[model samples]
Target: MILFFGTRPGKPETKKLFHSICPYCQQQGALTAFTVKNYFHIFWIKLFKISSHTTIECSHCKRGFYDNEFTEEMKNELSK
Candidate 1:
């Protein structure tokens, strides 16, 4: 499916977006959180942040996915 961003042109939008489905349960959802790591001279620190978008958890398996991973294809048909 084609996705649009702002009402006008030259706006930021997503492209070539798609969702990742769970192989075991066939459930689809967005990414809710991610992990980040900071490296120092001799040590490394890890941090996790929750995403702004709502996360979808599988009812059966209780697995969660984040929205950031999903991609959308921006269409310029409106400008035509």
Candidate 2:
């Protein structure tokens, strides 16, 4: 018998941060928050969610920041 199991990234969810500003671009409302869920799969079928992560990106400058690099204002707006 053979088994196929692995982890895969789920669909990405996006939200615009109205009150957040991009430090690099200095553009308000340009910050968009993206969240994705990682899932464990067995035989090409999703079994369970392993973890989730957040990423902040600037539409104007096309810069991306990880969760750990989030600023205070960015964190506040995302929490709400």
Each prediction's TM-score versus the true structure: 0.26, 0.83
Using TM-score, give the best candidate's number: 2
Write candidate 1's Cα lDDT for 1-80 as tens digits.
Answer: 65333221121332221244544476454222232322222122223322222333444576654555332311121122
Scored against the true structure, residue 28 in model 1 reaches a CA lDDT of 52
Candidate 1's TM-score reads 0.26
Question: Tens digit of lDDT per residue, candidate 2, span 24-78?
Answer: 9899998899999999999989999999999999999999999889999999998
Error of 2 at 10 (Å): 0.5
lDDT of each: 0.33, 0.94
Show model 1 residue runs off by greater than 4 Å: 1-18, 30-33, 41-60, 63-80
